[model samples]
Target chain A: MLNEKEKHRYSRHLLLDKVGLQGQEKLKAAKVLVIGAGGLGCPVLLYLTAAGVGTIGIIDFDLVDETNLQRQILFSINDIGKNKALAAKHHLEQQNPYITIKAFAEKLTSKNALELVQQFDVIVDGTDNFSTRYLVNDACVITEKPLVYGSIYKFEGQVSVFNYNNGPSYRCLFPEPPKAGSVPNCSQIGVIGVLPGLIGTQQANETLKIILEIGTVLSGKLLIYDALSGNSTSINIKRSEEQIDKTKAMKPHFASFNYDAFCGIDLINTIDITELKELLKSENIQVVDVREEWEQPRINELNALIAPLDDLDDFVNQIDRNKKVVMVCQRGARSLQAILHLKKEYGFNNLINLEGGLLNWK
Target chain B: MKINVIYFGMIAEAIGKNVETLQINSIQPNTDDLTTFFIQQYPVLKNKSFKIAVNQQMATNNTVINENDEIALLPPFAGG
Candidate 1:
């Protein structure tokens, strides 16, 4: 099945003993689905496309914003404001015409996840939130497909292969999602742009290995790469039947399972930054910033009171009870936690969360 | 006993260090006890969720820790 152009296109891969003519054929027959065309998704899509994977599917509802150019290398300034999956498809198609790339410009909801993942041989999770990540893992587990997982935070990244050859799933490692406000994302903190490239490349390599059956798969193993330290550490994990069964039990209700609630994407009283800006001009609202003092993008226009979430006890007496308090943090989750905490622990009822925090103020 | 313990992702930020030489005052402490010890030392760690790895292997609450073993406090990173 080697057309002249196909063989010439994959000449480099054809030369490798591990990925020769037969391996190239296998790759051409493999179908891989990538979720989230964001930071990690960029490199994974690029490399996988270049490697001549026969069919690739990308599903991301996000748009190609200017902020994505730093890490999402698929989109240029011309492609800004475009759907990420469609924009990625446009570039990847030019990279390798020998392959087929499918773009789904829709969000991966609970309803679509199971059916969509069932079509792919391997699922690559480059999503940025706990809810989607958990949803992807459960779908892969229920569908019995391998998932190549990668995540980045600041200068570090984590990579692992779950549900491969009956290995451990994500739940087997972290059975429960972290408290919603406890973990700050790249938007809240920041990420070294190159970090996801490294991690995503590793994920691409794993996908190729899985397809070619050449090397040791990263099943039941988690790889932690620290760009700052230039060191990679491995942690061995065991498959938990209980965790696997828990996911399988949801197979009947897979379409209706509320992953958002599972990950605590909660329903809390929130006001957007623009609304808060408008409110400050009219009413006397008390603004309390819940982020650490060291966090960036500080908004001084509100003349907000600084009360870090960790040490809120110190500022208990300072927060006015009579005033309508607006809680804020780097991304708003921590501020929501602050409101819930103050409301529950101290019986304060007049608290509201600042949606999306200071990061979205601009 | 003092052991080499490493922290990852947000856990490191909470502890204010990537790695540390932690001194355990308990006799043959389990993973649960070590976690409690850490929460007591760094109250900030009580916010983030993480798991423990003993010498490159995942540890359960009942997993025992020995002297000179490498320990890693790993957290699930939510970034891409």
Candidate 2:
């Protein structure tokens, strides 16, 4: 049944013992949607396209930035400032003309997640943030589609398959998001250039595996990889009945609500370094670092003090009532918490929570 | 009992390796026993967020670990 051109194009794949002509056919028939055309999406798109996947959908609203060139391999210098999904679609179409590539240059809000996901056989989560991750999981759960998920931060990456044939979902693993701003992004901490590539390729492999039904799917299990030391481990997870109940009740409608605030993405109220520098010259602003004693990125300048939040009562007496105060934490949530408490207790009308906290100070 | 312990993330940082063989006194060490062993060996890891995996699978606090089986300590993961 193989044509000359088709056989030649997938010769390497056909040669594999596990993935012969039958497997190749399955791959060709498969329809997959890869969300977020960023770091993880690039490698996922590349491999899926090269593998001759029949239809691949890419969803991303963000344009490529100069900073993204370091890790997002799909974009080149010329591709910078271009919409990521469009750029990835253009390149992937050229890579394999046999496959149908659909590019959706829009953010993956809850309103569109289910509609977009229903068209695909499997959904690959290349998204970088928690809110989108939860949204994708919920959408996949409701649609009964398998989700091939991958994520990267610094030298670490996590891969998992959620809602695979009634298997556990993302909430089964991490029931709730960490109290916001506690975790740092890859942008803030910096990931190894090849880390997302390695992880995304693994995600692509899982996608193919799910399509061809070749090997074991990572359903109900989480795989953690450390690129720095090259160590990998797998953890088995059982479906949490409570989490399933909670997710079942979730009727996600992004059009009705502000997801950034609902999920705490836009929680940062950051003032840039230039602003902080200017504030110091004025002396009207008091910089309060609310990070605990052991937390790093400490500032060693004037007007900055270590007034941790847990012991706010102890520091209440030390407050400078006459000046405007900028509260900071490792990320930002704690600083906001401090500001809320300070304004309530002392009537500190000049209190402002530093956006993005001290982590963004550099 | 000798068990193969697998460490992940910051737990691997605390234990300083991916896998290690540990000999314990009990036949089936409870969660308390395992936590105590790690606390005794690496005190700094007492507060690091983590979960346990038994025999190449994630397990609960009461899940029984056996000899020659793999046990993993995982930290709070922040990926996608």
Candidate 3:
């Protein structure tokens, strides 16, 4: 039952036949957990609060960066260094006094994913990495929670509903993650400022529809939006039996699943830019640039060998096995793949991938 | 068979074009064959991973492609 203030607050929602008094009550009763307080999360959080979603939980360990100001409208210049989840909650509560906003300023790991996700009726994925996406999907499968998924690139975005009423999960659509380094993130590439705003609102709409039981949800379908072309395409996704079986097999032990290992993100052989800079001044170390010759903004400080990844075989013999070899690429991805190749093919264990690659070298 | 292929996001950047029409001899070409043909045509896409969509439907490698089919190459984006 809406109180006097609540009735006046949601007057617009109360007028709708689809989302009348009963639907408004449902919105006030639903608990949605949103992961990542970045681009998509900002708008999703904003609209959800305005729509009167009762218990909204935000889990993001990231702090507000200067780069986030473009799309993350929840923060201003004053909230620059503050934690994203906390900042978002602080602002959202001010937006709607009738709703409850919970902020968890912690990373969602394999151990805590299920525990945190199980408390919510629905999960909204706003993360920007493959590992967290896979983890969130598997956790939702285990906990049997509906997931509202959205992703953005330069001028395009994808929105889908996964594991809704036992619908096709993310793994059913994308059985396996693309090989590491093959696909670059938004940071590596770049996104238009308004792309996330468009996509995030769609995600928030899906969440509201799910809660109100109105409209056709995006289950078993992918919504592809090209902001540049103003084209929207919907592709039907069929659930994979094999993937469902695999997910079922791990349901009992889902907590123990190592998503990072499953995604093959080798964190052991990575060296940050600062460490790489320090290593360059030391002896018995060779830096190898694995990027193609045509790739731009070459690293000039290091007298590194120009061994393009495709032609690494030709230059493999030139690298001394005795000296520690550090691999470099435009971004850190190619270098990690190079390290894996060198280790597997030539048995070169003395290699390290420069984290964030030459992009972060400065 | 001639198929209309569309590329999106990074896949388009690597292919240097958003859309193309490919002529293949196979009467009923599977996604695997289309992938091989595309990679052979655009060597830059050899290392990239993308999904194939046929006629606005997500398709598996075993899914068949016919003449005048609309196919799209979609790369997963991790951006928020």
Candidate 4:
């Protein structure tokens, strides 16, 4: 039974031909959990709150930064440096006072992923990295919860619903994470301010559709959108039968590995500063720093060259084929691309990607 | 064979546009041949890393390219 204020608060929603009284009731009964209160989470929570989801949980370990204000619409300049989940909860509650908003101000780890995910009717992933994406997928599979996933790069974004009614999981679509530092984050690269809002709103729409049982759900399908051309493409994803295991009958457990370590952040497997110093004695390989000119710790003694990523092509043409090129960048992403290009163009297969780049040089 | 060369993500930004086409007239051009063609045309691409997709699927360096196939030059997918 709708209360007097409730009826008026959502009168437009209740009057909609597709979403009537029953739909409103369905929304009121739904419990949704959103992971990450960053760019994607801001709009997702805002929309879900406006639509009157019964309960919403927001989890984030990060604090707000000046850099986040460009796309994180739920936050203001005053909220800078505050905990993201707490700030998001405070703001979202004010937006829709009738709906319940819970804030979990901690990192989402494998230990808590399964238990936390099982508590909600729907899970939305707004995480920005690969390991969390995988963790969310695995946990969703374990809990049989539907996941609305959205991600944005420089100018393109991808949105999908995974683990819905035994649909394909994120792992089924992307079996493995890419090699470390292969691509830069929005922090390293950049994204348009409105890109996340565009993608996040779409994610929120998918969540509502799932809750109210409305329009087509993006199950077993990956939708890729390009902001530049305004083009959208849907790729069909089929479930891999062999990958599905019936081991849920046994004790359910969470993953135990550190995602940062899994993503190659540890420096053990890579060459160290001393090893690099030893290699500098050889004239056969030329170390090219792809970091910007102003970046610190510039090497002056070694057999090295300064070539910013913007000028990599012009410098590539001048290199000698006899000398191997060891590319270096701040985070190794730009250097890897430079190495790949050198190997592809000049047949310099001897190029090596300086793991972790100059930041890990020591 | 004429193949449409599609650029995506950072690759498009580097190329300053989204779509382009390349003509290859061998029985099946090896990945090296396509690589050489691209580098020869746009020397700047020689310093950028990318993966080739034959009809929306990731292809390897040794993958053979057939005529009229839709080839996509995709930068690394950074999205979660």
Q: Candidate 1's residue-wise lDDT over B1-80, tens digit each?
A: 98899999888887789888988997898899988998999998888788999999998547999999899999998799
Estimate TM-scores for all models.
0.79, 0.68, 0.79, 0.70
Model 4 misplaced regions, further than 4 Å:
A243-253, A269-362, B14-17, B25-67, B73-80
lDDT of 1 by residue, A296-340 (tens): 888778898999999997997788767778998888899988877
Q: Per-residue lDDT tens digits of candidate 2, residues A84-152?
A: 999999999889988899999998876687789999999999887766787788788778899998877
Sorted into a CAPRI-style docking class, model 1 comes out as medium
Q: Considering every candidate listed, which one attains the maximal lDDT?
A: 1
Better of 2 and 3 by DockQ: 3
* Fnat for each predicted structure, in order: 0.90, 0.46, 0.85, 0.34
- Residue-wise lDDT of candidate 3 within A210-246, one digit each (tens)? 9999999999999999998899988889877777677
- Comparing 1 and 2 on DockQ, the stronger one: 1
DockQ of 4: 0.25
Give the best candidate by DockQ. 1
Query: Of the pair 1 and 4, which is ahead by TM-score?
Result: 1
Arranged by DockQ, best first? 1, 3, 2, 4
Worst 10 contiguous positions by lDDT, candidate 2 chain A: A252-261
DockQ of each: 0.67, 0.40, 0.65, 0.25
Stretches of candidate 3 exceeding 4 Å from the true structure: A267-362
